[model samples]
Target chain A: MKGFIDLHLRPNLEERVEIERIIKRAAELGYRAVGVSLPQEKLQERAREIRKICSDLDIDFISRIDLEPRNSLELLRSLRFLRRRVEVIAVKCLSKSVARQAAKDRRVDILSFSPIDLRRRFFDSAEAELASKTQVSLEFDMAPLLYLHGNQRINLLWKMRIETIIARKFDVPIVLSSGVSEAWLLRKPEDYASLGYLFGLDLENAKKAISENPKKIVERNRRKLSPNYVAPGIYVIRRGKDCPK
Target chain B: MPKIVRRRYIAVRIDSDQTIERKDFIRAVWSSILRLFGEYGASQTELKMIDYDPTKGLAVLRCSHKALPMIKASIPCITHIGASPVTIHVERVSGTLKALRRKLSI
Candidate 1:
């Protein structure tokens, strides 16, 4: 039942006060993790201030890459102070090229395919190839799914394809997130379980995607995720083992 | 596979060239059409029937037009004038709240 909320960090406009408010609220709400999106204009000092706030709270801090492809190295370099303070580096990959380039950086904790960018080009064949080459885990954001609901059948079809790719590929781990913006917009874990089941992720895998996997990401990156490493119990159901697909 | 309580249909003629396109088009229209047929189907407590084809440039859809407005509106454009079957399939899904209440009352 543990869930994470993306704080949608706005770098300017007195973010420390805003972030502290969210961190305290998140701690109260029993949220195990909080993700922050970096703005392109972020300076080294700004990253340090954010990192310090997260460290002080003993909350799991996840940094989502905010800069474009050309600025990725700079983004990585700027995030050095926050790296030891943050657990996961969430990158947006719009194309196979972007995904490949993002994959080159071992610092990236998760590679999420952007639906906005991948709408025209379905990730049917290319994504599988990329996953095979990278050995990096993939994540599907829920934002595009909502946006493309009535507009594109390809969007729905692509999600199905991506989930199928994750299952059959075996080498890559696929994580699912609602990519929530407003706290009230968070979907119940049961809701995701149904969608995952429909998309060929069995109950066990669905549970992992919802609960355990994020915890693992956070635990693995302890200094950034939190002051203490609290590894939760995980029940692994090997694909095609004990359950019929 | 479940016990079918209501039946309606959309019959479309399938031509070789545009079979897939016609099928996709009809299916895209099918969901909207069902909304128009909702009331009649609701009163009758029955399921729906759906069928369509592209080869003959015809679509036959069946559902209660009273309950669904969209279905009634979209049917005419794809309707076949000379086609013998003007039926639309209505499917009353099992375990619906209405069905559950009926069973509970009995």
Candidate 2:
């Protein structure tokens, strides 16, 4: 089996020091693959340098676009344009309408909340139901949990617990990420797996969130992007007796 | 029947721009545990700071085996000790301190 993957390393291109440190540190911490979230407009340009850095350390670099579409209409437009361009598409669900749209979109891989604002976490039972029918995974980031304190921290945990219960009930996959742009914020995979206990995930499911769930998301994207792909669980055979070519 | 006391040792590497003393590290870890798991979980952990090197930013901690997940969750929540930002990455965990020390060659 492949090693672990952290799907939300938000390394900014302007911060050269942070970009290098974040990628190198992730490699040292034992992540085999990482989905680097870049702004949609900057995706192609920013990927080159980050991909090179990751290759040096033998880390699989996955280009990811984090869409913060203002409305459902804007999300549809971005999904139409960016779906095939990036390996992973994570939507920053800031508003209720956007959250609902992102949750229901098959093109979207992860449904992420704002890191700084706890109020922006709009995930609930309705969103969970929308996400369950699709391939969308609810991302629970540990970065916010690290910095939030006192009552604010309690508030976020309570929200997370409720959302987690909802996700479990609807059978939506949950993906755990460091969700940190800084190198120092990066923790080992096992550490994040253990942190899963706080979110009401069992040990086995916690481990899977870090490894298997993310892996399946990437693999699903690859399969969809494959040239021979016809539809879900349907592919073309080029060399078989049933094949025309 | 006899009851067995299970213990685990964890080797952690601290990442920070400044040096962190053993006491501050302990305070941060303990505070995190209390904040997340409360006083009852704190008592059950049997948490102890066995060895610390301020210069190297390396430390070894001992805890009840059952509390391994508690230690793992608590340490990552410690983003700061006093005014300085810090992060602890667990490098290894073992049943015996000697085995952990051998693994780290310390």
Candidate 3:
């Protein structure tokens, strides 16, 4: 069965419902896995507890770090420090330069950009090409569509449509994330696909953006972080005496 | 006049904490579609609430075949109905209302 994964859900602990209840809600919504973002300091300890709840609910929990990099130096340092600790590393790029840099790095799984941040042409063809080349998926958050109203919503949708067009042109991998700060904000996978369709993706591509693409990212990152994995396409063969050299 | 309007029926399931009135739900859907697609696109859709069950939170909505994507695309934007947060999930889409009801068991 093709499992659906929400790769950018920020669950609010302060919500009326408990964290476990939120996880259960996600599971009930047909999400096989949910990537939860927490502060770097709280992630490790919180992830352990969250994982237990996720396991109980028969859902995979991914530890995600949402970083807002101010400069290249900070970006590199954060990547180095967090890459080994977290399952998913999503960087919210504040500038075109940072977006370009993040797209070129292998450690960065998702380069998340808010529609509000795209006041100018931040992601051009060059950045899209680099992202496609480096296999860094462009993350489009659905929170704005749910929260923003009137012109703000319209403008954000317009900006997202342009980004989607660019992503399609470059054949860049695009993943739709809820970016929900609360459990109630979580949406069904089909809902996310519908939003993706509005943002200029075809039905199949939109569905893939919410399911296959995100699943591939998680699977790829999991392998990359495994002890036997030396590098991309270079895994260790422990007992390969009979294998062709 | 000939029946030139090619229609499609979408089976939608509303997941919410509170019961949403059919009127409020229809209003939300129309507003969202209008907001996203504008007057011209909304005209193209010819959207209508064919049937609704508030208890089950299931509704069958009708729209032009050409504008089905736009309608489905706009459903997610109806995040709330009368201050109650809601999530609209498009369960199925069919050429006929009968088929949609049969498929969705509504």
Which one is best on TM-score?
3
DockQ of 2: 0.75
Tens digits of lDDT, candidate 3, B37-85? 8898899988888889999889999888988889877888787888888
- In the range B43-90, model 1's lDDT, one tens digit per residue, is 442324343444445444454423232333233222222322122221
TM-score of each predicted structure versus truth: 0.50, 0.90, 0.92
Instruction: Write candidate 1's Cα lDDT for A22-104 as tens digits.
Output: 55544544455556665545544555676677778866565554434435555466456445544566666555465565555
Could you give the interface RMSD of candidate 1 in angstroms? 16.1
- Model 2 residue B43 CA deviation (Å) reads 2.6
Segments of candidate 1 deviating more than 4 angstroms = A1-30, A40-59, A70-86, A119-135, A223-245, B1-106
In candidate 3, stretches whose alpha carbon ends up further than 4 angstroms from where it belongs are A13-17, A239-245, B1-4
From the highest lDDT down, the ranking of the candidates is: 2, 3, 1
- What is the C-alpha local distance difference test score of candidate 1? 0.48
Residue range with the least summed lDDT across 10 consecutive positions in model 2 chain B: B72-81
lDDT of 2 by residue, A1-245 (tens): 39899998987779877888898999888999998988766678888878888888789998888888888999999999988888899988878999999988899999989756877888888899999999699998888888788887888788888888898999999999888978877888988887877877887888899999999999989888888888988887674686665
lDDT, candidate 3, equals: 0.83
Task: Please give the range of 10 consecutive residues that has the lowest summed lDDT in model 3 chain A.
Answer: A9-18
CA lDDT of A228 in candidate 2? Answer: 83
- Which candidate wins on lDDT? 2
